[model samples]
Target: MFTSQEKKGIFSLSLIFFFQMFGLFLILPVFSLLATEEVEGATPALVGLAMGSYGLTAALLQIPYGAWSDRIGRRPVITFGLLLFAFGSILAAMSSNIYWLILGRLLQGAGSMSSPIFALIADLTRPEVRARANAMMGGAVGLSFGSAMSLAPFLAHYIGLSGLFWVITVMSLCGLLLFWLAVPVPDQDPVKATQPIGVLLKKVLKQPNLTTLNFGAFACSMGLTATFFMLPMTLKANGWERSDWWEIYLSLLVAGGLVMVPSTIFAEVKNKFRQVMVGGILMILLSFALMAWAWSSRDFVWLMVALYLFFVAFNVFEPIFPSLVTRLSDAESKGTASGVYNFSRFAGQFAGGLTAGILYHNDLPFLPLVLGAAALWFLVRALGFPNPVRHASPVEKPE
Candidate 1:
């Protein structure tokens, strides 16, 4: 069990994470619609670019922001990130064209605070309980995604796309406030980097296990981006109105959350990280297969089932992946290592969005088959993943 301080840190960090992700996901459901219908000078390809532009900027900056947090404290870097996010939200709220919206998204990604935030969570907890702490953060992210999916369309109906962006701005500000008022500072001093950035990058990249995990991140995020890119269109074709997507998302995500709770407990409590990963990847493959069948048959019920299965499987990895990264990485270089992992993740998002957009534009409906192949690759890699120590070692102190 966590002490009061650890509990406070975990709780506060989770809420802050929730706020940030809620803002980001809030736009996902309605983004394509906003681009094609409301914004001026929109093209199918540009819409995809606008949707994914943030991932490019975020991927580019994640390493520097993470390394910077290593020298300075997490607080200052996180605060700056939130402010940049808010400024971008404001710009997006004011934009009447796709180009400005894409620029706003780019600026928002430039903030790139995820690595530092996770590093802070690590600083606050011991290795024994770190997975649990990360699980909390993952739970927060899942909840945020569900809430945004359920709310965005309804909110969009009432407030328009600009208003949705404004809501994001407010949520981000709330996160900044929560950080200052609620989050407990860690006791350890910041870890200063002794090696240069290039050396650190090489070290992190050379770890075979981290390499596999990085590949997994790329594949998983690519699958997610492509899935969402196609999901909205699928629902529309099956008779669900744009605003009513919340009903499906809310129900399916809730079911996923239910399965996720038990699966998470089994993985961490039973020390079955490798099994969880393999099983999760398998689940991803099965989900894609179901989606392919649904598409071929135009079966609405089958589509819902596939999506529900997807949510269950995807949520399982949310906490486990980061927990593994932190555990496998050197204590002194936590921020840097996290940055590398997240860079792969966001880079996958960019590629997935662009590829999906191009395919959609060209009338080539190949996302499910492509994602299924990616999942197979991920599964092959997971088969060899080293089973990390589950509470077998003491938390290493920074050198």
Candidate 2:
């Protein structure tokens, strides 16, 4: 069980994550429409670039951001990152062209606070209960994602994409304020690595466990961006209006959230992390297969099934991966390790949007097949991955 302090820390940090991701995800369902209809000089290729530009910058900067946090402290880095994010949101809100929007996105990604925030979580929580802390964080992110999906289309209809960006700006500021006001500063000093920076990074890169988990992060995020890129279009083809897409997403979110709560507990309590992780990968593979069939047949029922399955699979992965990363990493390089993980994850997001959009415009039929192939490869890699070493049961903090 969490101490009261631990609970406060987790809740505050989770809210920060919620604000950041919620702002970013609010554009997922409606960005394509905004690109096609509103932005001048928008092409299919440009839409893909604009969609992915944030990830590109995020992927490049996460390592440095993480490393900086190790040197300068997490709070300072996180606060600056939130400010950058808000500035970008404001810029994007003002954009009238695709180029400007992409630039805003690129700037937004420059914040790159995920690594430090996660590293801070590791610092604040005990190992045995770390997974539970992360689970709560994942739950916050999941709720934000669900809320974003359920609201995006409806909000876009009423507010326009520009107005949506304004909302994101507000959210970013809220996250900034919450971080300073609520998040507990870790009492522990930063890990002082004896090795050189290059050597430390190289060591992190060489760890088989780290690399495997990194790949998992990449694959999961890639699949997500690609799936969102395709999902709205597929639903449109099946006669669902843009505004009505929220209903499907909301229903699936509720269903997936229910399943996720228990499965995460079972994985942690029963010490079945590897089994749960493997099951999730297989489930993702199966979801792609089902979605492939649905796309071809235009079967609404099958599509819903596939989507729900993906939601469940993703939620399973969300909490488990970071906890595993924390366990697998050494104390000195926790921030760097998380940086690499976030790098891969964001890179995958960029690639997925860019490639999926290209394929969709050039040869729509081949998109799912490509995504399925990636999932298959991910499963093969996951099969050989090792489980995290179990720690002793965590003790609560003193009252």
Candidate number achieving the greatest lDDT relative to the actual structure: 2
What is the model-wide C-alpha lDDT for candidate 1? 0.82
Q: What is the overall TM-score of model 1 with all chains considered together?
A: 0.95
Tens-digit per-residue lDDT, 166-239, candidate 2: 99999999999999899886766757556666776897898877788898888888888887777777677678
- The C-alpha lDDT values of all candidates are 0.82, 0.83
lDDT of 1 by residue, 159-210 (tens): 8889999999999999999999999987766566777777777878888787
TM-score of each: 0.95, 0.94
lDDT of 2 at 117: 92
Evaluated at residue 295, the lDDT of candidate 2 is 70
Question: Candidate 2 has which clashing residue pairs, if any?
Answer: none
